[model samples]
Target: MSSIARRAAAAAATGLTGAVALAVTLTGVPSALGATTGTASLGALRASTEVAVAAHGVNKEGYEGDEAPAGVDVHQEVSTAQLVEAADSVQDPAATGTSGTRTGIGCSGDGTSGNRVQAVYVGVAGQNDRYDAVVGALRAYTAGVDGVYLASAMEHGGRRQIRWVHDSSCQVVVDHVVLNPSDVASFGAERSALVAKGYDRGDRKYLLYTDAAVLCGVANVFTDTSPLQSNANNGGYAQYARVDAPCWAPQDHSVEAHELTHTLGAVLSFAPHATANGHCTDESDVMCYVDGSGVVMTQSCPTTHEKLLDCGGDDYFNTNPAPGSALATNWNAANSSFLFDPPAPTATLSYDGSAAVLAPSVPSGQGWRVDWTAPGCTPATATTTSPGGARLAVSCPSGGTVTATLTQQDGRTAQASTAASASGTPAPASSAAPTPTPGATANPGPSVAPTAPATTPVATLALGLTTVTPKTVAGTRVVLTGTATTGTAPAAGTRVALQRKQGTGWTTLGWARTSAQGTVSLTVAPVATTAYRLAAGTTTSAALTVTVTPKVQVSASGLTVKGAVRPAAKGTRVALVQHGRAVATTRTDAAGRFVLTAPRSGSGYAVTVAAQPIAQLALSAR
Candidate 1:
């Protein structure tokens, strides 16, 4: 089917409110807290990475007389070591400090990064598997085909402190709060009622990760609809979504990523501004609207073009991009905007006679191997999956020095040496270079070639000119239209500003939030030939100069005037003066140009351009 036809049919099927009612996945059964917050400094760096809040205009309730507000019920957040910095994983936790402004969000729980947080996860009837669905989808979106964690960067709006870890190593500590019918009553049906009833049970909430948590339910989420639909310009302190087709039930992580990013900020009614809605125009994004048909819509299928339930299964561009927008790409396509740099592995090494052990801190998905160089000593060459931590056994002289080489997932390597004594004399100083701070990239291969991808530049948002009403202007005002995508069509209600270059800086003339296909048309009139551009979020389109032609005609006669100009004009008087004495005066025609013929030339003459004086127009009839 044509992309347009498919989109139209999908819209007909679910009638999702493009912005608020985008279908998501998940299904949870009330489960217990499996792992406690452990002080496992196991590669846990103590650096304080800054987290910014994007939810600007949440619907805070004032129901002291009744139930709590929309996002009042606070959940416990899992405090796994928050990712601040990592030079290929092993990092100095104290090197960085927390940054970014924190707005008061209902779920900004405990004020401390929980050592662990939970939400009311609801999904398909009879199935108690919301947690797994979320986790799997989370894995699918955050950890892509290579298994590197890429979603957390969304929290800081593409600033920094992003890193990757093994699927086993980067495992998040999460718990769940089972959602029931009474719980979702607020979400599934009418909108504000969800808030009213939700305030009543404000007591139910679940786990918090480093990022803002979302309340997963199975109902439609928009309450006010129309004028409210115009709210892409605002943000919510917390997000409450209802997954339809409850088929993926609560398992659809793509939708989860979509709603979750709204709290962080993206594809708003206006780009770069966290106003109103939180969805992109791109259907591939987790935030785009979709026809709730099948269950699995996120994973990349082997078939080319074929997708599961309209989901943009290409996990590459999972999140939408805008000005300050963020996304995950292969390390090869990474630029300064991506959170994680091209990875270089870091690890610790030790050895015993006949055995050498090496542990590496990889940013997930990297395969690692350890090697040994000592008389009679050989270490295991097979790679230990990142989570497993590479370990090798070798036969070495007891009194001789044994060196262990650790290979990283990206082909970079680090090595250390330890001298062993039969009597155990302090094990001869061990030497494995300290890991660099996160964001500090390096390559140290252990006798092997690098496996890291080639360094290719990438962008946060892809914006370009698609259409304009008057291809060539015959007048001043022209209608210009265009498209912007993080990689897909933006959600409805998001803003796209029409900007004009004024002298040195660009100023906003007006905005056109976008239609379903991620396009916006705005009629703008520039007084003269002026330059124009489009701004959405932090992304701006290339400057599109709209050529404006002004009609300014000058003629000379006795007390007469004639002229023409476009768009029409703001009034200005045209004085016909001979020397310093006025002979005749008339207002410029409504079109901006004017004519004034003096009855007599008594002295010097001076006629000039609107703003700049024209010396050539001075008549020499002294």
Candidate 2:
């Protein structure tokens, strides 16, 4: 009957959805809840109000927030549909399902059967311009993925590369959505508006936000975003990707990639209870666990949410096969959203009597390292060369475990376990002389590596850049050729790119994959002195410096010296030489022509190009 009571009734009737201060309750209530209950049950009413918001799941374990009975660890529940991808049906028991689409993204006709093109539509919490940045960052982040795939190739032989099947550009689309809210939608009521607005259905949405103390991601699909995902069971619904605003703008790309990985597909065993410690085994990987210490962990979570664990520096594309790991299975689908994906690269680790060999079965740009720990000996690490072949000897008669791991240039690594044997029998005869480790004492006993397989191996890449002629005139087309090798044999079909050095940076002018003989050539015109090199994976050719010289045209206006610099660039100095002695000097103008002020007869005339500014600095300073 009272005015305040009447107003509350009207607000409640409208299905309250706003902020906590605005929620008519407190903090964050259901986007649909008003704070007014005007009674003692305001706590109970507010509790129910917060449940009405349409975001995603919120953490409640050890969570002392306004919700969850204050100050106790209650395990939070999340739905399977809300994770980056609902994998309940697509689980890769072998962790080898080309990520989200190992069998091929279901397509039709000229299409691969059972495959479909997948797209990710990015949405913000609200429509405000402030949220536009989230969409922009998402696009920028996804663009770098293609390059990462190529550059980080682990050399899985036989079409392991995630070569796209479509000539059309989109494996995944990164753009803003008109139907989704642009503000923080960590509650159910808000995201419900997105569904009503008619967004791309099927949990393929990525929402950007500013909230820091809530759910960063969920493991399944859900119907609502109430705290702890209580209504997640029947939500068989549109789950999405969400991260704090700072996460999108962070200094590292790992966070974005990490978040995207969740949406693509995460390992089911990666939860706290699964002994995975909320991450994959590799500490250096982008998907490593972030612990309570803020230290990125190299180990699994013994208990759930005890510490904050997420991806770390070692978290890069895990193309290395992970027998049963979900990360490997989901990598392709997560990266491209194409139902079709390529297999992770493959390699073999074996030992002759003395040396351990890690040989690539495919062409990979990535390097590898194997740690050899004999039955009772200290572990020693040996790394592969650029094109990637690593051979290190373990002490004989002490067979041990050989763990092969993908190695990073930054010295980080992933976790893997495999077996290695070095002994209990006589060493084999040496096929070739042992390559000595610097400062290592030669073993008294002769050691032989395993016999070479029928096929020669790809080696550490060695590249060379050369022109038919080292010197040439400006504008003259010159034939440039490059040679590449794995140091042991000619590297065939490896990607070789041409680059020109400018200042401290190198720009790619063009690229040609290598021929069977490991050669790449192209024709180029040099207008000025330029240095060029060839890059193959992590190896670069020696710099080929080409010196371009220009011929000048000289004439006379009765001793008034005149000349044109062939390149037509100014600063050439023309001298009037009388019997090989300079009688007058002048510099060329913008048109590259120079003229003397008065007449002076000369036996001969010559024009000299000005020294480069950098080389003339000392002379000018004097």
TM-score of each: 0.33, 0.30
| CA-lDDT, candidates in order | 0.33, 0.36
TM-score of 1: 0.33
Question: How do the residues 493-549 of candidate 1 rate in per-residue lDDT, one tens digit apiece?
Answer: 445666667668664443355787777776654445667787654457898876644
After superposition, candidate 2 runs with Cα above 4 Å error: 1-379, 382-402, 407-466, 474-477, 483-491, 494-512, 523-545, 550-603, 610-622
Across residues 393-482, which tens digit of lDDT does each residue of candidate 2 receive?
A: 455334455544533222334333334443323222221122221111111112233332212233467898887788976556678888
Which residue window of length 10 is worst by lDDT in model 2? 4-13
TM-score winner: 1
**TM-score (C-alpha, index-matched) for candidate 2:** 0.30
Which candidate number has the best lDDT?
A: 2
Q: What is the lDDT of residue 435 in candidate 1?
A: 44
